[model samples]
Target: MELDFWQQRWHENQTGFHLSDVNPCLLKYWPLFGGEGLDENKPATVFVPLCGKSLDLIWLASQSYSVIGVECSEKAVDAFFSEQSLSVQKEKSENFNIYKSEQIKLFQGDFFQLSKHHLASVSAVYDRASLVALPEAMRRRYVKHLAAILPASVSILLVTLEYDQALMAGPPFSLSETEVEQLYGSDFEIELLCREDIIDEQARFKERGLRYMFERVFKISR
Candidate 1:
């Protein structure tokens, strides 16, 4: 998908993929970081790519980690702060605008264009939607750029959906477990944290002839 595709999705209010509640997988896995053995400390800086006003941002902030979310839609960013009732300060940079509060900063711009400098302080990544939002052609580029920009030791908490593509087209694309390994195995260790058939939970997918849909969660580290 291109930039306009997502911008238009938000503009038209066609965001069925946007979850109203914080994801359960995130809540379960987040505490593993900054615990006794993990390298990450409390008050870590977590990066969220393609983060479209996800309630998870506020949840992460509530846990004391500073959050930096990169979103292409200004409306989504504005809605995040407004809906959360947080005060924000806006500033323009060379490539994107920064919407900042004490614990959260949202970058309103292209995710691919952001460089290492923009992500230098990122201690961890929480990718709930960014990877699956792209088509197969773009997924490789996204993973490569993500590995290059972040520190080598960074860990990632990722969630993906897998289903038969012939049954339906997707913005929530079908990402197989094998593909996930091939994409990040070269540089990061991959651990499958959760995998469960969620087709019954997804009414739209059931309507689209998807007999089975698996929601997979992974813990990735270098």
Candidate 2:
């Protein structure tokens, strides 16, 4: 994703990609990571890439997980803390502006610049929209970089959309099942949790001239 594109989107308040509330799929399916049994005294950390002021961060923190999120937009970072009424402190790092509260720390910078040391404590990852948000060329680089940096034991909960690209241009791009396998298969064991035909439910996408759209959820383990 281009920095200028996202910066312009944030400046113009053109963030339809920003959900009004936590994603329903996350509410119903987060426990599939089997992280609930982890010791509460030493909470597991969940990394959310390309996170954009999502309410899911709040929900995950409430579940006793230390949450780490990376986002490029500073406005989105500010909006998250302000909207949630969480007082946050800002700190400087070599590559990112770190925002912190109780259990959530959002690194504001380019996602590709992140390294393994930055994610040393992560036990799991939740990709509610990251992978599907990128174009075809960037998606492969995104996955490869992720695989390179994450610990071998990390688990991921990924959500993706599948639709015909010919029907529309996308940042909410259509990612086929085969593409997902090709991207994550070699390094991780993938499990399909569920898939639902959602075109009828997505009035906005329907308006964009899409006739069919499917949402798929996968639990990926390394």
Candidate 3:
């Protein structure tokens, strides 16, 4: 999808994917990557890409990790801090604008344009909606750029949805298990942490004639 597609989504408040609460997968698995009971002397930073105004950022920060979120929409980024009633300091860069507080730092710009310099300190990644947001063509580039920037020790906690694409068109696309392996298996060690049939929970998909819908969680480490 082009920038306009997402820009329009935010502009029109067509953000069904934006969850009001922290994701259950994140709450359950984040600690495996050192999100909980963090040591003050050795704090880690978690990088969140395509982080559209989700409550997960605040939850991550509350776990004592510095959270850095990259979002293309300035409106989404602004809403994030504003809705939280937190004060942010802004700085301008050639590629993006930075909105930062004590625990959170948000970069308003393209995720693909971010470099190692921008994300070198990241010790882990939390991807709830990023990979599936793109089409199959861009997913390859997203994984390539992600692997290029993060350190070998960094682990990723990714949550993805899988379904029959023929049944529905999506920004919340169908990402099969095989596709995840193809994308990140060569570089990172992949582990399927959880898989659940969520068709009943998703009334919209059920209404669209989708017989099956599954949510899968993967733990990826290099």
Candidate 4:
């Protein structure tokens, strides 16, 4: 999707996809991937790409890693800080207003404009809505840019949806296991940590006349 599309969505408050609470999967599984106790006093940072106003950022902060969120929408970035009741001091970067606080900083600009220097301090990635939010044409470019800028030690926790594509056009694109491996195989070791079939429980998806809903968590390491 184009950047304008997202900006318009946020302007219209059309963020039905934004979760009201922290993701359950993140809370339950974050510890397995070197959570708070594992990396104390080390000054490690985690990168959240295209981060919406999900409470996952707060959760990540609680886990002891400084959080860096890159977002294109100004409304989303503003809402994130405002809802948290935190004051953001904005500074002008080359192409963004860097909204910064103690443990969190948000870059309000194109994600592609971010350079290695901006992300060099980061050691891990937590992607809940980034990859799957893009269309097929954009996904490869996103991955390539991410791989180019991020260091090899950076690990990633990625969540994806899997379902029949013919039924609906999606911001939440469906990705199969094979596609996941193929996309990140070049430099990252991708592990499937969990997969859940939720065809029965999701009445909304079922009401759309969809047959399946699959949620998968992947761990990517270099």
Predictions in order: lDDT: 0.91, 0.89, 0.89, 0.87
Clashing pairs in 4: none
Q: What tens digits encode model 3's per-residue C-alpha lDDT throughout 1-222?
A: 887899899999999999889999998887677735322233389999999999999999998889999999999999999999999999999999999999999999988789898887887899999998999989999999999988767888899999999888897899999999999999999999999999998897799999999999998986
Residue 199 of candidate 4: its Cα lDDT? 80
C-alpha RMSD (angstroms) for model 2: 2.1
Question: Candidate 1's residue-wise lDDT over 152-187, tens digit each?
Answer: 678898999999998888979999999999999998
Which parts of model 1 are misplaced by more than 4 Å?
36-40
Candidate 4: misplaced stretches above 4 Å?
A: 35-43
lDDT of 2: 0.89
lDDT of 2 by residue, 1-222 (tens): 587788788889999898888899888888666445332233289999999999999999998899999999999999999999999999999999999999999999999999999899997899987998889989989999999989878888899999989988997999989999999999999989899999998899999999999999988887
- Ten contiguous residues minimizing lDDT sum, candidate 3: 34-43
**What TM-score against the true fold does each predicted structure earn?**
0.96, 0.95, 0.95, 0.94
Candidates 1 and 3: which is better by TM-score?
A: 1
Per candidate, the number of residue pairs that clash is 0, 0, 0, 0
Question: Hey, what RMSD does candidate 4 come out at?
Answer: 2.0
Better of 2 and 4 by lDDT: 2
lDDT of 4 by residue, 90-177 (tens): 9998899899988999899999999899998998889989998998889888998999999767788899999998896787888899
- Those runs of model 2 whose alpha carbons end farther than 4 Å from true positions after fitting are 35-43
lDDT of 4: 0.87
Highest lDDT scorer: 1
